[model samples]
Target: MLGGLWEWWRRRRLLVDASFAAPLLLLAVFYQGELDQGIYGFPGVGFLGYWALHAGLLLPLVWRRRWPRATFAIIALACFGQWLLHVPLMAGDVAVLYGLYTVTAYCSFRWSLAAVLVTLLGAVLEAAQLANLPREFRWAVMFLSAVCVGVWLLGLHMRTRRAYLRSLEERAERLERERGNELQVARAAERARIARELHDVVAHNVSVIVVQADGAAFTLDTDPDRARKALETISETGRTALAEMRRLVGVLRENAHESGDGYAPQPGVEQLAELVDQMHRSGLPVTLTVDGTPIEVSEGRQLTIFRVVQEALTNTLKHGGPRAAARVTVRYAPDAIEVRVSDDGRGAAAPDDGRGHGLVGMRERVAVYGGRVRAAPRPGGGFEVIARIPVREEART
Candidate 1:
């Protein structure tokens, strides 16, 4: 039931305000003549007198949001004046009651309480003057007290309810934000774990294959049969890597492979040479350099570096001038690997369209590995892309 009401409120906020405002507008029109006649009570005061007094009191209510304290003060004075004159409580005075209640609910408690006390005092004085009762036994006084106290209490309750609803809304929003943050953290951690596993699989397999291929090629001149055997081993190793890659991808629920192990080998830092060789064959002037002995990296960091280099090369091919020269340098230190890719080409210094997903992808990769990327135009006139990946393998896991 509360949910339905909330939905209604959300869907029709303007409608509710309009419905309340229309009646107030109508009341204003009906009482306008009375107000014109009763300004300072000009000649004999009639029903017009009471209506005009209340018109002033209620007129300010239209601007209650702008001047709440002043509106309530006007209402309290009008109500007190009418009580003293024995005006028998005009129907228009009901608007003053609503105004007083609104003031109490929306304004400071001290202000609202002061208004309530003044109204009660006026009610007491009127009852004492008009009611035929002894000072000891005054039912009229009690009735007056009840009326004033009841309005005040009702307004206070409404204020409390409003405050409670506001608190609940703020709390719900805080919890929603916390949940979103937790989900994002969990997702990032999972990706890092998968990346680590993939790196281990790729590096170990690729390194072994490259070693055997080199040895077999060296023997090909003297021993043809052995060379053939070595070539077959290279083929088998390639097939195994491909098979593992497929198997791992199969776990993603895609129907790429009908049978056999679904895991596939994912490339890592070990495949840097292979990547450079492919780009070389594709007609780009590419060079690869390594500083310091290679150290083990978390699968996640390896993947991030591989992707960064791949993206840098891809951008060069798409944007660089013909026969552009590009170089990738990886400096492996004790704690981190700093990679720098620079290209001497015309398109290198041009601005990116800002729509390419590659930049976003690179950022996400670096963010996961607790790394940073800087892509800018070099002082010598070309584009340089640099990525630094920390080597906290345990932290990545």
Candidate 2:
């Protein structure tokens, strides 16, 4: 509530300043009226001059912040004229101090310094004007000079503080912009990764379904049992592909589940045996072997290994001939884990299409763990994919 009030006043400052100046003008007019009526021993100043002088002294204060230099100039001129014409003491003169403050805080110190000099000069002339006054009364000039310097210093302090606050606000804005940019980059990278996962899942599983469906169609009558088995493989492969899709899509969801059932966890190294068994049923005839003790790796690294093997064998299914067979070897080292997928198939005949992104995805995933992937045709025949994911020393078994 206080914050709202301060903001409201800030917007209407000109009206507030005018309101302050109105009271001062009224108070001075009352005193000037008494002085004009011979209520004191001082010489009577005319009503016209009194109104003219006091208005010039205080009314300009309304615009002191908006046009501080012009306001101070008008007030300083009237203040000097008040002394030259022997005007009686009025509260309107105090506006000069406020005008000087506005010039110091809103304008530069170099400009306010001249107002300080003029005020000092006025103090000396005021001392001279009250020459017959007592020593204690005359000492008021020193007090007035101190007040002038004190207000000037206060304005200077406010100016420095305001500048510092402005600089801090600008710095905060710059940091916010940088943070927004970083989030956009991270979001883009994540979307690209999800795209790669989708491609690998769909391409691999769809290829298995196509192979099984083609075999079932060819042997539907002559080999009824083999046809039934191929149809079963197709159904199971479709369900597996759907599960993989849900796992990937769950990453984008807020509730982490669909239809009141939790999504399946991601495929990892432990699931390799099941994956190989499914591939054998799909007519891909893949053999799996593991070497050395497995290390305790992060889920992301394990997913990297699984996806690399999946993409390599999927490519072999698409390009390897009917008689082809594949071997997947997982070698566990102290500092690294490796998956080498090689197929004894006619891999050299595979199209070198620049459109393929499976290898690209494999490289991107392994690169996250400071690892590398090598994919190329074997010396005599077939194709091989070796992805080595570095294991942190602490994760070594």
Candidate 3:
């Protein structure tokens, strides 16, 4: 209940306004009473008129923030009018200090400085008038001047602090937006990568299955034994495609199951021979040669090499003429691994705009390992793809 009441009080603007106005109103009343007792001589303004002026000076403070410059102007004018009439200063005159502070805190700096100067002049004038009075009251000008400067300084400090806090909040919001944008970009790149992997795995195997199925159907009556062999090749190709598809699907369903059963290790350079045999069965005569002793390679870099070779051979099968043949070479160096896949096909005649998805995927994969890839038509009649990937000793182990 107390928390609810506190929240209610905090939200009520009228209560806040009254909190400030009531105290000054009581001070004005007290000063009026003192004047009535003949403690400070008035300038012939009757009791009612003096009280009315004091009320005007003190009540406007309720709306000081709503109309800061206007409120300060009204209060300053009232104080100057009272001084011009030679009325004795009262405690109600202290409201001018609050007016100066409000203008500095809520209004622009130029207006606030203008109020400061005006208040300073008023203080000097009051001091000049009281200068010839008594020794005990001579400190009035210095005291009022100090109060005005101190209030303005406090208001300026508050304004600077509020601006600084606002800037910090804006900076935090900007960084959050940038972080969200970076995540979106990363997600998009990953999705594209998965699409390319699926394409490389499925397209190659499906193409071979289609070719073997056609061959089996064509030779079934004329050569029963050859037809049986083609059927067997089709079955093997389909199973390999299915296994790869399951692995790709598992990657897509990440975190869906914790058993790790759905995931399979990605193919690497060690599987290059099996890949070449598959292509040979698909009626593409392909050969692989290795130079230098084999070295341990990170799974990621190995995958990059495998994909480069797979994509090159897939392009050859799709676009290379029936008699096309391919050769793959891997050279291991102390600091790098190099792969080359070249096909003696009708590549120069194949229509390609150099923007095929397979080529783009190969480049993206190689770039992940800070590798360089080149794919271009050879001078005579074939297509060639070469990739060189740098390796770190730690990664090799």
Candidate 4:
């Protein structure tokens, strides 16, 4: 119960109203007799007039935070009116100092400085009238000056502290928004990579299957043995394609909150020979050569190399004529690995507009490891794709 009441009292409106009322109640009880004495140089107003003036000075403070300039103006006018009428200072006069502090805290610095100057001048004028008591007048002016300056400085300190806290909150909010944007961009790039992986895996294997199936159909009656061999090759190609597709689909399923326990591992550099053999079985004879000692490569970089080679050969099989042949050369340099895929076929020029999705995917993959690729028609009569990928020494065993 006490805690609840304390929270209620801490509210601004309740606290302001209470501050206005408490002084009025205290003055009515303790200072009524002194006020009634009507000392010389003080206003000779009756009880009703004194109470009216006191209320006018203190009541405007209730809206000080909402209308700081207006409230301070009213309080200053009241103070000047009392001085003009020669009214004695009452307990409620402290509200003028509180009004000045509020104006400094809530209003702009120029307005607060203006209020300070006016209050200081009023204090000096009030002090001058008491020349008969020089010591008391000096002390009074010093005390009033100290109080006005101290309260205004305190209000300025509070304003600066509040502004610093607001800046910190705004900076935190902006950083959070930037972090959210970065996360969205990362997710989009991951999805695009996954799509490219699926396309390269499915397209290459299906094209081989179609070519082998057509060959088996054409030779079914004339050469039973050859047809049986072609059917066997198609079965193997279909199974490999199915396994790879399942792994890619499993990744998608895992991302969608499904089981991914049976997924296969991604192919890398070690599997390059198997890929070449598969192409050879599809009736596109290929020759692969390696130069210099092989060094250990990161799985991601190895995958990039494998995919580039796979896409290049797949394009050759799709576009190269029946009698075409391909040569794949890999050179391991001290600082980089270079690959060249050349085919002796009816080579056509690559599109100048860069609209080929397969080439785009290869470029994107190579770019991940700061590599470069070039695909164009050879000078004589073939298509060639060359890629060079940089390697870090620490990435090797």
* The candidate that achieves the highest TM-score relative to the unseen native structure: 3
Taking all chains together, each candidate's TM-score versus the true structure is 0.48, 0.53, 0.55, 0.55
Between prediction 2 and prediction 4, the one with superior lDDT is 2
Off by over 4 Å in 3: 1-7, 133-139, 210-397
Write model 1 residue lDDT over 1-397, tens digit each, in one string: 9999989876774454345445755665565555566643323346567557757665666666556678767877776776656655444455555666777888889978887877777667767766775853377778877877899899999999999999999998987897667656555544444444554565566776898888888998998888888888788767655544542442222222335533345567889999999999998888999999998664446767888899988888777777687999999999889999899876446656533555555665676556888887677666788988877533211
**Clash total of candidate 4:** 0
Candidate 4: misplaced stretches above 4 Å?
1-17, 20-29, 36-42, 207-397
- Each candidate: RMSD to true structure? 16.4, 18.6, 17.6, 17.8
Model 3 steric clash pairs: none
Q: Which stretches of candidate 2 lie over 4 Å from their true place?
A: 1-10, 37-44, 132-141, 167-179, 206-224, 231-397
> 71-151 in candidate 3: lDDT tens per residue?
888999899888888877776787888889888887789988999999999998888877776663458877878988999
User: What TM-score does candidate 3 get on C-alpha atoms?
Assistant: 0.55
Q: On a 0 to 1 TM-score scale, where does candidate 2 land against the true structure?
A: 0.53
At residue 98, give the lDDT of candidate 4: 76
lDDT of 2 by residue, 82-134 (tens): 88887655788888888878888988778979888888788777767755677
lDDT of 2: 0.79
Candidate ranking under lDDT, highest first, comes to 3, 2, 4, 1
Q: What is the lDDT of candidate 4?
A: 0.76
